[model samples]
Target: MTPPVPSVPPASQPVFPLPCGMVLRPWREADAGVLVAAYEDPGIRHWNRPEPETPDSAVARIRRWHGRWSEGGAAMWALGRPGPDPAVGLVGLGDIDRRGGSAEFLYWLLPEGRGHGAMEQAVRAVSHWAFTDAGLHRLRICHSVANPASCAVATRAGFLLEGTMRGALLHADGFHDEHLHARLATDGPVLAEPAPGS
Candidate 1:
């Protein structure tokens, strides 16, 4: 007989809180339009996300994130703002492997939200949550070396630079070297200075 499906809803998610007034929750159907617009960013299109995405396509991808959560494979949260403000960022653990106790993490933000130390705040919150609440031993974050902004976010969240993998990630622009960073459960909060006001 086949074994029963494994489940890990406890680590899968709930809402995660961040400093300077932000939170990370599951993606909503209403977020489709916003996601599509966000992806229109040249940096986002060139560095992250699937190529050539439409609003409908964004919705489909968002749905898939929900599926990932249900299957206990990933925790893709929609970064939420305070009061009635729309979400300005995103942060979550991808490639969640329970047996191995490691996962790949990622984050991105809208244009207006850039350069305010907000993503750093979000990253620390998500990483701590993953290492603690999610029962993960280590979290790995990698990005194309060309993206120094992502590297900054990773470091600010306490992820130490492990190494660079040559041609490790393939995108529409072709293979790009990746900077690998990692944080372990035993690590302290290496938060970057001065959390910005909301």
Candidate 2:
């Protein structure tokens, strides 16, 4: 006889709290404008190469994120302060391979989200959830080598630099070499800074 479909446990999606006082929650329709603005920002657009976005399109994208979660393909969150302010960033896991126990990290921040360590904090929170709660064996974060900010965030998040993938991605300028950073579930807590005196 054929085996029955594997049973999956029911659980609610989690909202991660960042040490920098920002929270990562499921995307809302109201955040569509922020998403559009993020794509319009010159810095974000140059690096991320996001598709053109409008209010309606952004809402549709958020809906797709919801659908992707239900399909076990992705989990995404909007990063924002605890009040009524709009989301200033996006963070999440994409290209999830349940059977293989792996996923790729995706993120981008708006202008208001820059200048502080918020992205790093957000990455750390997501990594923690990906390893412990999600039960994933491996997670990866890839960024264009030209983007030093992303490199810093990945490193601070405890993802070791694996290697450079030549012409791995095409940015707005041109094909760019990408840095591959990965963290295994076995890795300990995120690295901490040394004491002032050593």
Per TM-score, the best of the predicted structures is 2
Candidate 2 C-alpha lDDT tens digits along 1-198: 642332221245688777667899889999999988988899888887888999999999999998888787798889999867899999999998876788999999998888668788788887877777667788999999999989988987789999999999987678999999999988987535422321
RMSD of each: 4.2, 3.9
Which pairs clash in the backbone of model 1?
A: none
lDDT of 1 by residue, 42-64 (tens): 77777786456677887898889
Looking at model 2, report the run of 10 residues with the lowest lDDT sum.
2-11
Candidate lDDT scores, in order, read 0.76, 0.83
Off by over 4 Å in 2: 1-11, 190-198
TM-score per candidate, in order? 0.85, 0.90
Model 1 error, position 78 (Å): 1.3
Model 2 Cα shift for residue 81 (angstroms): 0.5
Question: Largest lDDT belongs to which candidate?
Answer: 2
